[model samples]
Target: MNDQGQGITVVSLLLAGLLLYGGAGWLLDSWLGTRLFTPFGLILGSALSIYVIVKKMGGVKS
Candidate 1:
């Protein structure tokens, strides 16, 4: 794929990660009556997404 396509894929993966995990966290907070999972989920999601993207991209070019 071209650079543009790869860029789009990366953005999509990041958004999906944030939304999916964040949503889960929100649900958990509502269910358990807590107030901390959302941020935690967002952070976790971001980290996991970065890890996946790096692996998929075969690590840094330089």
Candidate 2:
């Protein structure tokens, strides 16, 4: 795939992960006893999403 395709994939993943993290956090805080910090969820989700993208992008690119 070209650069644009790769970029789209990464952006899609980031957005999906963000929505998932936010919804999960909201549900957990609302229903479960465990209280998760909102910012923490975003940070972790973004980090995880980027990690996956970088790994899939073939690690350190020259």
Candidate 3:
């Protein structure tokens, strides 16, 4: 895909990751009666998404 397409894909990936992980974390926190999982979930999601984006875009030369 082109740069514009890639940009959209990356953003979507990031948003999906954040929502998925964040929701999981919220659930975990609710179940465990703790408040530590939300931020961790967001961070982990962001990191994973960034890693995936870098891997996917590795072939693009600018």
Residue 7, candidate 2: Cα error in Å is 1.0
Ranking 1 against 3 by lDDT, winner: 3
Q: TM-score of each candidate?
A: 0.89, 0.75, 0.90
Per-residue lDDT of candidate 3, residues 1-62 (tens digit)? 88799999999999988999988998999999999999999989998899999998867487
- As for TM-score, the candidate ahead, 1 or 3, is 3
Model 1 spans with C-alpha error above 4 angstroms: 60-62
Question: Which scores higher on TM-score, 2 or 3?
Answer: 3
Give the least accurate 10-residue stretch of model 3, judged by summed lDDT. 53-62
- Which model scores highest in lDDT? 3
Give each model's clash number. Answer: 0, 0, 0
lDDT per model vs. reference: 0.88, 0.78, 0.91
Per-residue lDDT tens digits of candidate 1, residues 1-62? 67898899899989988998988999999999998999999888888888888888865564
Clashing pairs in 2: none
Instruction: Please give the range of 10 consecutive residues that has the lowest summed lDDT in model 1.
Output: 53-62
